[model samples]
Target chain A: MQVVVPFAAETPKTRLRSVLSAAERSRFARAMLADVLEALARTGHDLTVVATSPLSSDDDLVGVPSTVRVEVDDRPLTDAVDARLPRRGRTGEPVAVVMADLALATPESLEGLFGPDADVVIAPGRGGGTNALVVRHPDFRADYHGASYLDHRAAANGVGASLETIDSFRLGTDIDEPADLVEVLIHGTGRSPECLRALGFELERTDGRVDTERSLDSTSADSRSR
Target chain B: MQVVVPFAAETPKTRLRSVLSAAERSRFARAMLADVLEALARTGHDLTVVATSPLSSDDDLVGVPSTVRVEVDDRPLTDAVDARLPRRGRTGEPVAVVMADLALATPESLEGLFGPDADVVIAPGRGGGTNALVVRHPDFRADYHGASYLDHRAAANGVGASLETIDSFRLGTDIDEPADLVEVLIHGTGRSPECLRALGFELERTDGRVDTERSLDSTSADSRSR
Candidate 1:
């Protein structure tokens, strides 16, 4: 099985710009990618990282213990992933595509997406995106866009492929917004949480929903002591 | 296409005993079944209501306009439903099994399950149950207990069936507990809400989560006026 992780390297985490600076967002995106890579590494499958921009060996892929083959495909998500999808009705091997921003993903959840008996296994994201999927049928292709989970289902139907949808909370939480940072703080077991805390983010409950608030106490503690 | 609705008519909605008496629960169950039958009637599929006990035409099938074939199966859910599943590789027609307590289900949501082009179309419940499913493949069978949605996914894999899971909030909410009554009041457009309202249930919000509270005002207003 070949696993592909599609990353938006050049302009990643644009939704987090309200809370994270340009450099911080870049670093945060890499932290999330590292967490995803760590989980996929435990599965012992061939890993590939498809980045929109070229990644640095000394920076982006640093600290990832697995041997990840990085491919530079600056194209949009749908085209880049579709190009990597084995041409319909040709290959016998199954290919998996996992998003780079699933900060809460674990080996257990990835196993659900990989070990299913169908021709296509889909783990749908909370926001109607296809966070992770394994394509086993040779006729199936990837289509990533608005409500891509539904599109993928229809695509599987189009190719007459057997499909299974895995309902997993961890694989569903993609870190894309300032509010989404709180999930990493609450459920994350990787470098993504440490990276967010270093940037001064903390969990706060507002109107009965868990949200993130930057702690001013970190900077103001010294001034108050004086 | 054959749409089979498995109903527990003999001992139904036992979980809602805290808020409803035995007689009220039976009436409420019948009301929900009527709503579901109405929705299925609009889809133009052959409807079958498989009840654990025989249904009374004067009471259970009273106001439902659709021609529903009723079957009395005293066995458990898995056995009763599996008995109806077509033998593997023997038939090409699809069989749909929908739970009778999906109080929030609509004709539009049912269209999502019926129109999809897959071997199996599953609508999962919030509590890890399979609320509705359309099995297009002959090898597939029903398994409904202890996270039956997951079991169904594995069953599809076991028999090599293609599957799709639809994400619809209306189709997901099965009215089993007192708390689930709120969804019927909030989103139900059928006889279920009218029956609930007649029983004095009203929507209430607490800590930003919607809940249900029986209205004492209707009875107390008459006493207060005197």
Candidate 2:
């Protein structure tokens, strides 16, 4: 299966401002990207990183394998995905879109995603967003906006494409808000959490909410590491 | 308005089994009940704690004032709420069903709730359950089950009860699972979090998810307090 990860590169993870500075948000976004890429790379599929902007010189993709390709597109998510997919490809293979912020996504979920032999296979996010989806039919294109899952289903029905939905908790959880950091730290054990911990961020009870805060003890103890 | 809290006292907070033991679950449930009761009591409305079983003599409702009444009922949640509402009470006054786990619910939210002159007003939980609802029309009743919010809306429509939904984050935060505890710690300053902290519970990032764990440092450092 040909996989494409629609990543917002230049202006990443603005919703995380409550717990992270702009630089920290960028760093955490990259870390999440690295984690998602590593997971996708392990599946041994031909993948592409469709970024919103040109990659910087210092912004290296650490865990991404050489098998993955990179493309830059400045359009919205739906347009970006639509622009990438071919109406008719070599041997008529299927294309799948995986979100880069899905830090908990595993190879097992990806395996299940491709197992369904439908013209269109969708994985919906918890908050009404289309998280990951696979399209085999040429006429089927993604519409990734508010409640895009429904829009995609309509498009599939209009094109007479058989549709299937993949149920995955890990895939369903998308890191979009400050509250979502708790989900990443709890359900993941990868580059993202490691990066946060490295930056002295620890899960602490802030007032009454579970939040990420800089651990003063860690900062002093690991001053030399910085 | 008559406020009826449909509480599952016997099987309280079984969903919290992931992090808390059975005894801890009961204690935490009671603390949440107390918090809800306290919030409701502040509204100066005649309130009743409709219990699934006998509220234990030792179940000292710490913050619950004297105005609240406790009644034992073994029926289902929907039935317990129905049985408690007076047929022809003071000036055909409306009745409300408030879930006891809404620890973050405030007096202001309750004020806004009663202020609305509607046949049926609902405050929906994050996970689709009806957290708190006010039923003015005597013909209207409650259906507290999976996606009860939808059920309530349908019921309201069926009976021609003008439906109103309260949009408050505080009213929506109902503690149901281990992850829900993080919400309690972050959004509320009630007996629930206090009891959890008193029990040595603290927010910790286990693997990658936000989780409640006993503070080992507190156990040693503040041994005398315990």
True contacts kept of each: 0.00, 0.00
Candidate 2 residue-wise lDDT, B18-45, digit = tens = 5566677788889999998888888988
Off by over 4 Å in 2: A56-58, A86-91, A205-211, A216-226, B1-51, B54-226
Encode model 2's per-residue lDDT on A45-103: one tens digit a residue.
88899998866556557656667788889898889998766586545778889999988
Candidate 1 stretches greater than 4 Å from native? A88-90, A217-226, B1-226
- Residue-wise lDDT of candidate 1 within A1-226, one digit each (tens)? 9999999988888877777667778888999999999999999999999998889756787656649888899887878887777665666678899999999888877887898889999887643567899888877878675557767899999999998876565776677666567668766878999988887777654322245778665432211100
> What's the chain B TM-score of candidate 2?
0.88
The ten-residue window of minimal lDDT in model 2 chain B covers B217-226
Mind sharing the TM-score for model 2? 0.51
Residue B186, candidate 2: alpha-carbon lDDT: 47
RMSD of 1: 14.2
